[model samples]
Target: MAQDAKTLDLIAIGRSSVDLYGQQVGGRLEDMSSFAKYLGGSPTNTAAGGARLGLKTGLLTRVGADHMGRFIREQLEREGVNVAGVLSDPDRLTALVILGIRDRVNFPLIFYRENCADMALQPSDVDETWFAQAGAVLINGTHLSQPNVYETSLKAARAVKAAGGRVAFDIDYRPVLWGLTGKDAGENRFVENQDVTAKLQEVVALCDLIVGTEEEIHILGGTTDTIAALRAIRKGAPDALLVCKRGPDGCVAFPDAIPDTLDEGVSARGFKVEVFNVLGAGDAFMAGFLRGWLRNETVETCCEWGNACGAIVVSRHGCTPAMPTWVELEAFLSERERPFRLREDVELEHIHWASTRDRVYDELTVLAVDHRSQFLDLIAETGGDPERIPHFKTLALRAVRQVAGRDEARFGMLLDGRFGLDALAQAADHDYWIARPIELPKSRPLEFESSADVATELTEWPAGQVVKCLCFYHPDDEIALRERQERQLLRLFDACRKTRHELLLELILPAGMDSDSRTVARAIRRLYSLGIRPDWWKLEPLQDAVAWRETEMAINENDPLCRGVVLLGLSAPEAELLASFEVVAPFPIVKGFAVGRTIFYDVARDWLAGRIDDEAAVAALASKFKVLVDAWRRLRGAAEKAA
Candidate 1:
């Protein structure tokens, strides 16, 4: 394959596994109460990290035919990585690593890689055509520890090299994986062995770029001295770019000869940031370095990118998730004096949260069935049992499914756990854009539905489920009332941030509050002044284009990254709602609508009154929804043409 034919920027062929990190910091793995699962493995992290930094990356590894395997594949796909090379092995289970953050320097971990799926990767699994499609291939040292995997990785490297592609090696020296240390000592960085050194040298001879820590370099060079180790590897592959990661001191790159002093090489100073867990910093460094190197950037720039990535990761938890996006990386690099405590930098944290989101809704058409009180009222009015509300919600989702079918990416649902638990589960399983209600229905001061500790309550919910809080707030309310509402909203915003859930703040004017174009916009501004930035805002439609622009400006000035706004129905008739859609459709910030009663009230009431069967109710609901969807799309189309 020619270099011009290379579709992938990088292909990482090595270990990929699920890492369960202890949630409680400074606690022993044995005493940890909970563990948060994240994608792990050095090469895997690098692949994901590279993708997050705008690289078209692929992972050439095997995962078991299990839920964990699906998770690894899905997560890589979510990161925009090519998963065509992530094969499934039926015989072996996926690899797993249990890690705990004891402190900044002490991270305890245990690998459960007894004949894991990734280790079972065969040389035949290396698709030369696929490998040739990448500009570069990265192989980790752990894969070179075993005879079988070593040959497999070697085949991948040779394929890439043969096709006018470069090869990079990460001297990921793990002694436990090499059988040089006890099985439980996964945290041990290095254990010298002549066999390992010989194998590493063979890999080093085939690489165009090499990266590792000083201890890793020592292991590869068959000596305890860092300079001597570099000299030995340099003698074998003298033209290779050797990068030495020096932890917090940053990193040094030797493009030619090994220098007497490490500082004599082209070096980039690391950021001064507090360390949270340093487990995956080196992987992050490799990813950041590749982002520059693959672009034919200077070694100094590569070191700068690598050092900054490592610093950012060390200040946070997990590996792949801690990897900064291109926007976040640029923001950090653009800083004149980077903050030492990176976690406290609200702007950076917000940027990370906003930019790293997997889902991006260009136009969201949501069916809102999260009405608890309204459903109960309907059941009572129809003399029907409230126990059937769950089934009704499930059927409502079925109606949504009938219209959405799987190809339509714009469809979403706003469901409540009280009556829509089954529907929520189904929607989540299908990976729909779901928003679940958190606030108690019709609460004046915005009280939570079940638990006062909304943060803890959110832990039980799926990470992708957006927390939708409906606040009937008005800026001109009495100070006491306004303060109470703001206080609860602030608490909810903080909780959403902590749980890593997107918040959809639905703000409505109290029954009557001098209605005007700027009412909702002012309310949004008030929330912004209170420092509560939601990922999304759900508002009632404004009367005209000027009102819509005011709301858009408020959101844009407050948070340019806000996920845009969706119109709420407020049980308006279909004609009325369609007119409102036309008025707001021209605005760029108005992303479709989330209307419930307008689409489902009549149909659901008729079903409960025995005037219509399930099929009739579903058809009626789907027809109403399709009308609104078509209207929104038609107006949006016209607006686009006008623009």
Candidate 2:
């Protein structure tokens, strides 16, 4: 709040909530079993998106003194957004939204925000110092509809404008939030009341820029006609730049004068893309426009960036998490042959999430040694103490260090809690990523691991670590098997959600069904149909590029937010595994290889048999691991060039 060169570029004040989106497509909320969580609300999204675009943005709002409140603050900090103005209210609860994707057209949602923390923001909570530091102050229309928060928003806007800061208004009208009953609350766009119009016009006259859709313009201007409403808006905010968002038709901008014809004003063609969810498009457009407006760019360029950002968000899932960065926006704009439809390409999603992720992984080559009892049986012949099995995991950890020392690679190890908990704690500090296995081995019916329950184990692990679970599943037409498998998966999926840990599901086709591309693809789709969106798909190597592409398409089509697939080692020979890399290298979606037995099986066995020393086993495993990593890098380089 103090005077400093580190002042914010934009300060957005209004509603913030936890958006829980149903993963089941075309299903009613009552029947939904899985939901993806993200930071929601118009102003919150704009703050996060602007920060992602390299703007110094801050949010001035209130969240309840609970986990949700902490979540909002932590996410803002992680995205490099300033939260000095975000206060916590212990007297109320944070807002929550449960949204469903019934199709591309119908996204039914319910808001649970009665007496929420953000709505309870009093004038005393207003931080004028924060507003004074920003170049612009953004106000959401929803905030102006309330009495208490409305006064606070008005005070902040007046203070900022008086201090020579720009006041921008985003007409983010939500009928349900306004307690309107004349029409269907969720579908109401324009109510056209004299009192509402007068209140909005008062703020419109004090703003430098106004952004809204046709419906919002109708409400603010108190007219149903688009042209008349825009003219009315111009009369109030004579000098402010006006933006009219026309869904798929693109947006038109009025820098100074209102045009008689739609084509007369500066316009930018909208990026045509298949719409998955339209909830966050408007917020993304605002963030993109502000990026150019704050930099003093041409109206046409601003419109281009706005349209590009809107297109990217609508093609993906949630708002704040899916907003594209400047790098992604530029790359998407440069592509000449890219399809306009939201094809949900795994390769593209992988690149987008990895590039925008908080954790940096230049190149990942993970050594997965989460194998359980069957592995112990392999050492039974030597009459070795089964308790010494953990030493094998420690040997694999040494091998990870060996490869990491040679090249600057981001490595991860999938360790089992059965005997590798200490190994996990030790490996946690070496700049290595860790994924602990969660499923009990060799269970045809499938169950949680014997040692730790889902909740207990997750509570003990480090925050933000990955949890890997292996299941022997096949997509046969048996209803009982499918239902049983789905129930178990849902339980684990929900656990991961509550615990905030990432899930990597290693799916193996049972011994009977054909492991052909189509069969495997169907199995993957079936899992997704049940709303199982894993962070990564650990699969056995396919035969060729065509088959691998088919598998990639299946995973992408099911869940666009999925992180991507990682190759699994089914104990194939080193030569066979190397050949498989040549096939998958063409697909950028296959981020990196996560091989276990192929890299460590023989060396581990020799070490257990007393035939190899610790140093010898580590060197052997490291050498094999490097071969696969190098092969993957070569193929990935070629794929990137082709892309």
Candidate 3:
């Protein structure tokens, strides 16, 4: 029960569910055609939101032993939340909620939680030692509606309190969840019920902090008057900090006496923005408030953090995914003239997109075998069946596996869906960093391979696969040609943003364009000016250190959150590629190489011509790939040593 013994900042206990949000805004749920899935439930969102804000948080709940449960656990882990206590219950199914945004004020939702796994949470599921390590614990009011979950949450709260940790309560009052309304009325936030009021009051009495909106406070205080509700709650838990979330007007906090007016308490004004969905705003506010409160910040600062977080989430779509990261939160707060529409803020959106990505590759040594036309041409030259190209692509993947040995973080494959479908599936199964091509091979002015509807096409690709579009571009191209290419690129960039897929824009100078060191950098700047900020850039290796610096500076100045760059091999010989590596050794922006023809051209040709067996081809390809990797490492090491 020592302060030093507590390691985690917070542990959230209560509901966890998979939310299927109707994609069509301003449409009724019955007429909705498509849905986007996101993690949901009050405590789960709080845990993830807290973790995203740099808190060491944990979740204590039960999920069904199914794919959805695995998704919840994996997502929590991705958010940097400790899931040691997220147990899988084989007896029940995980909870689910189908939600739709009809408009700003009308959000229709249905919760299918009739004997769900989270409600099956038992006292036995609460681990005392694990609960004791947290500095604070948060339990939502929904968990108290059921006896089993109520006992489970109470036991965990007692464990944390016994360890000198604080307990916070979020009065997440849902009348449907408490069975006070029809099963279909999940959108109903409150229903006056004496039993619900008494139950919430019991939980509120055990808290160091209590947070709720006016309706929620009404349910807890058994009164509709805001000041009377505070007086009621203060009488029960006199020392607890009471935070009242007043939607657009921001939030207010009371540390001691119950004030006659809500404005008498410590208050912070919310941002002026259009509300998209008010589903997860309170959970975000709770996470933000904890970020400051756990750090012992002033009450005003806590209110500000909470208000900003709520404001940002209300203007976004889903709950858990809409939670802002610490960097995003700071950026939003640092703005002097805040945008009226937070969703339209380009820099904030970029920060959210970059920071919330599930994976980050510090360095990528990828095998660029995403060539379609080149493979067909090679097959034609060898008089071999084009059918063998897919198998050959599979062999290339095997070669990468042999060299990388499942080290997915450091190694990747740039494969095309046309010939490398099977290989792409296998690579994705092993969680490799994969990129697939969209642009037709060697198309001047760039045309998509399959369909002009790139957004629809991207939906078929796996979420992990980056949309790799190789554009034959030159900054000095004729105005018409340049504009056409830029339009296609802009379309592709917009598609990637919609599909939530990372894009790697590979820029190559068309066959006979005169170029200097500044050409590529200028091309990058032109794209940035057009607002085409791809997550990754694939460029030909620069000729000198000055060129590399220019490229780095261009990217850094335009978008620091750009995922850096990967060097592309344009069928260059191995010696030439190695020399280019030496030139790029000192620059940290060039992550690694995605060389194809140099490593695989000869081996692939020999294999296609039946001059070499599969094993021989794989061995040769792996050896060549390892040689380039080693050369990059050696040169990089030497540069480090010299510095």
Give per-residue CA lDDT, model 3, range 125-243, as digits (tens): 99999988999999989999999999998999999999999999999999998889998788998899999999988877789999999999999999999999899999999899999
Every candidate's lDDT: 0.91, 0.81, 0.91
lDDT of 1 at 74: 96
How high is each candidate's TM-score? 0.99, 0.65, 0.98
Q: Residue 624's C-alpha lDDT in candidate 2?
A: 89
Which run of 10 residues does model 3 get worst, by summed lDDT? 335-344
Residues forming the 10-long window of minimal summed lDDT in candidate 1: 335-344
What is the Cα-based lDDT of residue 29 in candidate 1? 89
Question: How many clashes does each candidate structure show, in the order listed?
Answer: 0, 1, 0
Quote the lDDT for 245 in model 3: 89
- Candidate 2 regions exceeding 4 Å error are 1-6, 182-184, 345-347, 361-414, 417-432, 437-643
lDDT of 3 at 107: 98
lDDT of 2 at 578: 76
Error of 1 at 329 (Å): 0.3
